[model samples]
Target chain A: MKIGIMSFAHLHAEAYIQNLRAIPDVELLGIADDDAARGEHFAQAFNARYFDSYAALLSAKPDAVLVCCENSKHRALVEMAADARVNVLCEKPLATTLTDARAIIEACERARVKLMTAFPMRFSTPLVEVKARLDANEFGRVYAFNATNQGEAPLQQRAWFVNKDLAGGGAVMDHTVHLADVLRWYLQSEVVEVYAQTNRILYAKEIQDTRVETGGLLMLTFANGVFATIDCSWSKPPYYPTWGGLTFEMIGERGVVLVDAFKQNLTLYRHDLKRAAWNSWASDANQAMVEDFVAAIRDDRPPRVTGYDGLRALEITLAAYESAERGEPVRL
Target chain B: MRVGIVGAGSMGVVHAASWQQTPATLAGFFAESSHDATRLAEKYNARVYKNYAALLNDVDVVDICAPTHLHHDFVLQAAAARKHIICEKPLARTMAQGRAMLDACRNANVKLLVAHVVRFFPQYALAKQNVANGSIGTPAVVRLARESARPKRPPNNWFFDFEKSGGMLLDLMIHDFDYARWLAGEVETVFAQSIATENPDAPLDFGLAILKHKNGALSHITGAWAFPPPNFRTAIEIAGDAGLIEWKSADTAPLEFFLHERAGDFPDVGLPSSPLREDPYTTQLQEFYDALLNDTPTRVTAEDGLAALQIALAAIESARLGKPISLAEARA
Candidate 1:
């Protein structure tokens, strides 16, 4: 399968290229970027072609196009790919608005093309094992969970990431979709309502900076009676030195299961830190997600993270934005 | 190597037991001028000091396990008498007092170590090892929580006085704060919120602090002395670019050490039953003694204690003023 990339702009674009290159079943098709310089850089680095325009890449009609564009651009890219009858693996936050998201889904359906939201977190081995354990009542009755999403303040890196119009919302929109989607996937339930608050206490940028807060706190109630919270932010200072990953605690009726997907440790203890290391799921989460996305393309299968799932998570992010803006809970 | 413990409370007992079987001598015990010194003296097989001056002048190393309010005076006196010192945490109520204690020890050329025992905990030590070995990559996010159910009857009434112990931030949360600072580094800024319920008539027992280091790693710490039962739960999750590492005291059952790393295959990193004894206090005392005897450095230095205390105080000040507090602001 020749998997060409649509943008080098999305943060995970490099990972997409590297993973695609690593898989034997896939070939690296030329990449397209709005900026010719970036496209040329990737082309030279990866030994692929460079296109200055999205239309030119579509005309080449690669087997699949990885839509690594911003949320606002997802809709147009998906529509263009569907019209070209090209399959798509869209980066998360499927769309900026519900209308555009719904339209993309309809276009993909009408064109009979495979459309997948690249939510590779679902493919994480530890998370999948956690899901299995939760399903088998390994940890017991599901109670509450605490999830955190922290990264470098985006505003410190680029001005557009903090711009509400270009990026959607700040940290909440940027991060919660992934966490929310993972929560939904793990719980196998819908998010019924959300009460969230956001502010720009860290990044002093003025553009759609609603999402570029020093920190964000959220309370979510899933339909399956599982309660979860997401403390999201780009508030980590430079000196502390860390990257982004997921660490969470799940309380059940039988026992509590603490799983860190990024860390790939699923430890079950009798009750304290002094015990032995339990069975830990050690598969590479990101690689697993990427492999699944590629397999879906090759086998005519739907992705582990469907476009609908991404839309739902995107809805929650948007709802959180509305709630923060209106100072009220936004019901899903 | 005779050791004189200046408090006969629970921690004092822990300390006394740690020193008794070791090479160090259990010189005697002392109580606040008001407490029942004679009763405690009888239980511990030691003499009672009616006068702290007599105790300070008598013992080779004066361990200040006294309440926070008494820490400053006792340490100063021990230093004046040229006694080696190991004082309990929050070295003093205020940074100024802490500095004074440091100055006194320096002037007297006495070996002074502060008991930041968390670093010596086998589990945290292992967690530190993983981070140092690039197991988690460069840690981007650190979420640490230390929560305990409020004591049914807090020992000293002075614990409620803000001027005495520096409130919960110093008295209880300082453990997590110190550990976070040690694991992370110098915190450049802090934004915090706290609650002191009038019904309890106590200092702030529950709160959250967001700390930023100069290196860009963000730390979220939620500490409470107001849980429902006598539970000591502490968990740390560090997310790095390559992987994740976490520790939860409660997840390691039957044992007291809780350290978990992302492993492809299980490696037996089991901890031996206490290094010198089952008590960490003994290990601490042994380390201090070895450092002095061998002309090495103490594991938990006075400077480490001071940095931890400074971060704790910064969190408190942030909570007090309802804003993000900076270390620069703290120094000013």
Candidate 2:
């Protein structure tokens, strides 16, 4: 697949470059971004041709385009990709507003092309396995859920990401969508209401230092009896213990399922550290996701991460943002 | 198989219930004191014994759910009786005690398995798998915790007594310390700060320890017994150059793993809660049974338990003296 790069404004844009390189079937045709310096940097780093503008990049007639630009630009980017009759793998928070998200979806519909969100975590192995297990009724009646997506400060690193107009909301908007989408996808349910709080504790720059709430907690009541408590905060130090953490816990009638994005070993100690080693064999899911995406595109099938899925996740993120801003539970 | 349960306290009951829930049969039980023993025995329709030696002689397998202070003597008694053993955590109060138990079990040719239930937790196991498979590059840092709401019942109230439970370090934080050692490798040194029980009348219930591993992996362990209510949690985080993995205990949610999707993309990964019916206790017990049946070494051996205990003891020493304690000094 000849993949052309959209604006390299979002941090996720770099990932598209890497993923495109990782997949043998995908070829990087050209790249463009409003930030001339960033576009040049990306083009030079990925060894791709630099297009002066989105129009020039579209003119190159790539098979697909990855929209790794800011949320505010997602709709326009998708529309451009659709006008050029190219598939899109848009970065999350598909749009700054629901209206923009809907418009992007409609444009993709009108274009008759695939519009998959770049929610790569869904393609992770542990999550896929967990989803299967939940479907198998391993935990029984999934009664409640709690999730956290946390990290250190992102204000100085990616200032634009904290802007409510550009990035939507802080952590609630930037981080919650991925988790919110998983809740919907795994439970086959939608969030009905959300009570959330957001804060800018760390950053004192032009953009909110912490877009997501630091120590911000949210209570999400799903369509089913699945009550979810979510914390989407960038509250740790830059060199936080976990690179970036997403924790999901599900409670059921029969048992409980707890998923940690990062867990290496589970051991016990009495008086020393030797002889107490509990090791299990499980495969990693990153390569699987990339491979699956390659296969899906090769077979002309819908991607594992659909645009509609992105829409749902985006809705929840917006809801959380609204709830935090209004100081009330925002109903979906 | 007909099983004998040692210890008749809260965990003893939990174990007995878990065994009953499984295909295993509970034939008898033994408690240090006859009262708790009789209570558990009557509830489970099993025999109760006051004498550890007599209890060892009656059962094919000895499930050592006794207090940490009693693990050494009970395990030695069980080993001499030629009973396969499954011992609860903090295998012994001291490394010497743990080593003696291991030596005795080895001489008797009886399989001795120290219960490291965290390994049995599916989420933790998955996290371990991720680390082994290089999910997060080489494990660099581990931040873990064993937190609870409040201690409804403690280890004979002696848990606060350092000679018995080794305070929060051994009774609780030892789990994560062992995990850090396992995933990140040897602990070269540890610096810890502890919250002494405010009410001198009360026991020490909270502690925090920072471990510096031989391989430069930094681990942080925090534990508290006075949380809220009915909240039992264990969380482990391992970060590597490539990605990160975290195992978080959940009352509700499935076990999940998160990986790096993009270099700097904020929405790196997401995980759906994976549910499971099997718990750490059952898995540990099964491991014990398998080791006994197959003439295999236990997954968590006595030596490993001792090492973890040493770390806990070191933490306590560090806290007490308000100085960083090297493993060498700890060993001494």
Candidate 3:
């Protein structure tokens, strides 16, 4: 049950540290980031041991590692973890390219360890409820999904989110993978086609150095004949209540279901803040996700969301990018 | 001025109610045989005409709320009678029909207001105005989803026939299609997917469409006939650099009552309504009436309706063709 965090590059590590703390059996062994200052800061802030480097942390023989590195850096970190015979819970997009995603999966397979994508939304309470109903055929045959995974540009907390090289792409690359994995899981089908359009509407001028799309609309067709659109955008303003939210309306033959996963919140207007803010009281999907990651290693079984799932999602993001460039639908 | 509604179905009853709130008088309603239409006519202290021609003869303005396939004929007959027209959306089932309806109205020198009611919705109008006025800077991405309960209809009902009703895209989603264009000038391309069910009981349909606007904006629109009645939902999120505007029917409603013994079998009762004082349909009809009185122009002109229809048709074509369709190719 010993686990180490690979990098604090992605902000989700801030929450993951607390999530791992809540688990009874899982020990958050230590922190490891290439940036010594960052490694020392979080290790002290969270009251954990600090390692000089990711390699040093891996050599310490932690059972598993959580890779919260930048989008493109996931492959390197994951490959590094696999080389050390460690299981991995990698952050989303899996990798910038389909080849890297496939290679990561193969490397993990060869090393005899599981690689799980950090798609926490798969464990989201409300979304999980919907999936159960869908699996039970209570929603009849789901026909379409209208979903959005939107947020304010992660410029302040993680500048790498907007960096084209580090993040792979912008909003589409950053957000699309979460729902893509969920859709494949719910529909039990792989995406057959991807048609997408991206825009530099929100942060083009603000982040002039990096040329990346801040907004994207994607249309996807599943093998089961289900169709969906994902609005993955960093469109929330800085003054908004929180980062943003994930919302969807699922259409089915029996009935329609609407999910606003992050809607459980109280609007707080504090004197210290300039604007109103939403204080969400949502059940922690991240906590459940990490728990599953730990359970998989303990049971010596595959994680609920696997490396192939990550590969499938990565394929979607890459196809979306290709389709947007060619101004057409890219067939699988 | 007097207003008579044609094909007294759901939209007919709604338009009849809206007309009663205006300065104009309610002339009557014409349907093949609609019990609800008779009830609505009685409630408004109006007649239920046995024939379409008779209703057109009496009313100053003809409000066509018939099936999609019948709009062209209804509009043509109304225009021949030299009556001003208020037509429910999709404009027409086909581009040719929409263009013909526009030409007929123009040649007759009668005012034609394609009743795109969402434009008159205060929230939607305000959101569009905010985007135009730079409240959100340059509008990058517009996202919208409209969900309506699939009301039970007779097996022979025209609404059950996709050919007659033009399916969910034309019947339900054309509203969002119009709104998307209103928010982002004109659409240059459309890609879409649809699920058409064969279940005799529900016969539900769901559609998703993506529009790339000429203004460098992208819009995602979803239309569904799946939810339970009174559980109808609408959501919009327009994101730009300066800010974001988001709203949902369930969230913004002034009242919410989750009755324990409610919401199955019997559907369309007291729906969750927001704090808006006047009904949006009333506002739309009144504006059209005033335009006819002043000999000015309606807010949603026939050309605008045609344009929205063109985009909707393009989406339908995209879904049918399994390809990304340019607006020009769709029009051709």
If ranked by lDDT, best first, what sequence of candidates would result?
3, 1, 2
TM-score of each: 0.58, 0.51, 0.91
Candidate 1 lDDT tens digits, B1-332: 77888887656777887787578778888887436556666766777887888888678888888888789999988888988898988788889989899999999999778988777777777888887887766655677877664444445556677888777778777887787777777888776655555444331256667676776666777666654343467778765544556666666556564456455322111112333435666777788777766758866789888888888888788667645567876777
Q: What is the lDDT of residue B183 in candidate 3?
A: 84
> Which is the winner by TM-score between candidate 2 and candidate 3?
3
Top model by DockQ, which number?
A: 3
- Listed for every candidate in order, the interface RMSD values in angstroms are 9.7, 13.5, 1.2
- Per residue, candidate 2 scores C-alpha lDDT tens digits across B50-146 of 6766676677888877778988888888787888888888888877888888889889987777776766677677777788887666654466767
- For each candidate, what's the DockQ? 0.03, 0.02, 0.72
Model 2 sits at a Cα RMSD from the real structure of 17.5
Q: Write the residue-wise lDDT of candidate 3 on A35-140 in tens digits.
A: 8888889999999999998889999999999999888888899999999999999988788988889889999999999899999999999999988988888976
Would you list the clashing residue pairs of candidate 3? none
In model 3, what lDDT does residue B31 have? 82
Runs of candidate 3 with Cα error greater than 4 angstroms are A23-28, B2-5, B25-60, B257-277
The TM-score leader among the candidates is 3
A1-332, model 1: which lDDT tens digit per residue?
Answer: 87789987786888788888888978877899886887888788878889778899989878888998777888988898899998888987898899988998999889988888888778776777788877786754565666777666665445666766777777887788888998988787898877565555454433344435545666576777565667776655433323445667664444345566656445555455455443545665557677777788778888777789888998898887886566445678
